[model samples]
Target: MKQLQAELHMAMLMITHDLGIVANMADEVVVMYHGRVMEAGSLDDIFRDPRHPYLRALMRAVPRFNMAPGERLTPIREARASTEHLISGAARPHVAHAHDGPLLTVRGLTKRFTTRRTSWFGAKPGGEVLAVDDVSLEVRRGECLGLVGESGCGKTTTAKMIMRAMRPDAGEIVFNEQGVPRDVLALEGDDLFAYRRKVQFVFQDPFSSLNPRMTAYDIISEPLVIHRIGDADERFARVKELMGLVGLDIRFLRRYPHSFSGGQRQRIGIARALALSPELLLCDEPVSALDVSVQAQVLNLLLDLQDALSLTYILISHNLAVVNYLADRIAVMCAGRIVEVASYDELFRNPVHPYTRALFAAVPDPDLDRKLDFAALMEGKASNPAAWPQPFCLDGSVKLPLLDVGDGHLVRASADADVSELRA
Candidate 1:
């Protein structure tokens, strides 16, 4: 889309969550929040030195590979220290201590969809599409595991299976609750209901995820009402507590979702998710729809809630920067399978897979000193699995496996690839 705009000599008004796209493609940038322009300036001026607080927060929220280890992102609204009390009684049992192994383990998960093809004259059966193919990964207790890939890469599909919103054709989803492994797929009735209480999801779009007719209080309290966790009085208290926890004014509880901004709506969603105090939070591109400034506030709220609640997160997003900001480890998916899994720093510093390298190359560096590699990008061979060099390439007949490089880092490559030779 960007290239076509440039080639035609057309003025492009691009709207995107990707700061990389903005940095690389935009000559002038306008930052907006709640349908109002917060700041406007040249690309260099906006990125190099942001003047507005919202703009500054937006810049800080973006995860740069060059950041020092342990650098913390500054949220727009800094959470209050006293908000910890909101989560005191709401936390689920057996989540306080760090487990010896993974909190949730998915093994050989596979999901295929068969579509029916329809023509003008007639309809016929379509071939099966493998949405998620033999994918396996683990999410440790009290840590955020990022699942990243382009659209149609199966990140969201995998998350849905984990949430049990959709059942997989094959594989095991093991939930290790205090060393007791419960098979998620095998659960029924009360067991399934209990599992749902232990896990909750925050959706991608705040606007659509919420009900327009429902007030903020009704939306957040609906979960508690469904679960029958507490009486009306207790649920009302919980709702107010949740509002405070997410940095919202309690007075707005009676206001409908349409009255709130995108960020505020998302906060209401987060509060709703926390009503049951689930141990595992599956956030599907939670901040992708918000403005850059609002994105920081939501991201920071998630971090603060994670710490206060001891929550484990499986965050699925296409934005590597957002993943880098929150994820302790990241799994890069391609063609319905994970191609690489590594710690944030390790993956950024030494991306081994061709696709992983391609993704890193695509991220635009905000620094004035560092420019994008147009030559490398123009090649465009890295994303094509067929174009990868030997040991990384997989012909139709080759049996490729996810091999361990070292230090817990894993990469999918040909079975014949020398593991030691591939170590960075």
Candidate 2:
């Protein structure tokens, strides 16, 4: 779309949650919140020096690769209702990890799909698509593991397999409960129900994920009701407790999803996910549908919840900034395979994969001194395995493996490539 606009010399009005897209494609920016324009200026002015309180919070909420250690995200608190006491008391339930092992491990995961072509006459068989290909990773206890990629890169498919929403064609998914390893794919009947209770999902779209017919109270308490955990009174109390945790007002319990703002609706979703008291949370672009100011609030709330509940998260997103803000480690996926996996800091400091480098290069830096290099972008060609340099390129004949590049960082390169050559 960007290429088409550029080639046609067309002026496009783009609406997106991705600041990187703004930096790359937009000349002017208008930041909005609560149906009001918070700030408006040229791209440089908006990103480099935001003046509005909401705008500033939004800027801070976005994760930058060059950020220093111990930096914290500052979410907008002016619009939020007071619930400090509720938050403080909500930190009671803590799940202990066995030693320091990963809470979840996914190995050799693969999924395939066959597309059929439809014509005026009839439907014809089409080629097979590799949605996910032999992907493996681990989610450490109480830490966020971010899965990042461009669209159609299988990030969401991988998350679905982990949630067991869809069965994988091949692979093993293990959830380590304390010390015992449970095969997620092999479970059935009551065990699967129990697993669902231990792991919950937060969808990306707030409006569609929620049912407009259901009140906030019913929406949140539905999970509890399904599980048959508590009686009517007890479920109502739990719903109220959840509302407080997500910073929603108790009075809004009677209101429908349509009555609330996008951020509030997301909070309600989080509250619903928490109803089961899951140890692991799979957030599929939870904040992508929200406004900039609201995005900060939601991100901050997720952080707080993770800290308080000792929750482990598998956050799937295309936004590098969002993932960098929350993830302890990151995995870069391309062509339905993981090309790079590294610590949050390591990946940014030194990205080995060509695709990974292209992703970082595309991100618009807020600093005035550092501007995006349009020529360096290569018009998105870096994503193609065929376009990569010698050792990194993967053809059908050559076998490539994820090689350890020291300090626990790994990069997928040709097995024949020497460590020195791979480093280069």
Top candidate by TM-score: 1
lDDT of each: 0.84, 0.84
**Candidate 1 C-alpha error for residue 6, in Å:** 6.1
Model 2: number of backbone collisions: 0
TM values, all candidates: 0.90, 0.89
What lDDT would candidate 1 get against the real structure?
A: 0.84
| Superposed model 2: Cα runs more than 4 Å off | 1-58, 77-94, 98-100, 420-424
Query: Per model, how many backbone clashes are there?
Result: 0, 0
For candidate 1, which ten residues in a row score worst on lDDT?
Answer: 90-99
Clashing pairs in 1: none
* Residue 114, candidate 1: C-alpha displacement in angstroms: 1.0
Can you write out model 2's per-residue Cα lDDT over 141-192, one digit (the tens) per residue? 8889999999899988999999999999999999987688999999999999
Q: Residues 1-424, candidate 1, lDDT per residue (tens digit)? A: 6678869989989887657668887899998878999889999998888898877776676666666777777666664423656544655434545446889999999999999999996889989888898899999998999998877889889999999999999999999867889999999999999999899999999999999999999999998988998898999988888888898989998999989999889989999998888889999999989876578788888888888888899998887878898899999997788899999989988888888877777667665555667666538776566777878886554547899999989999888788888875
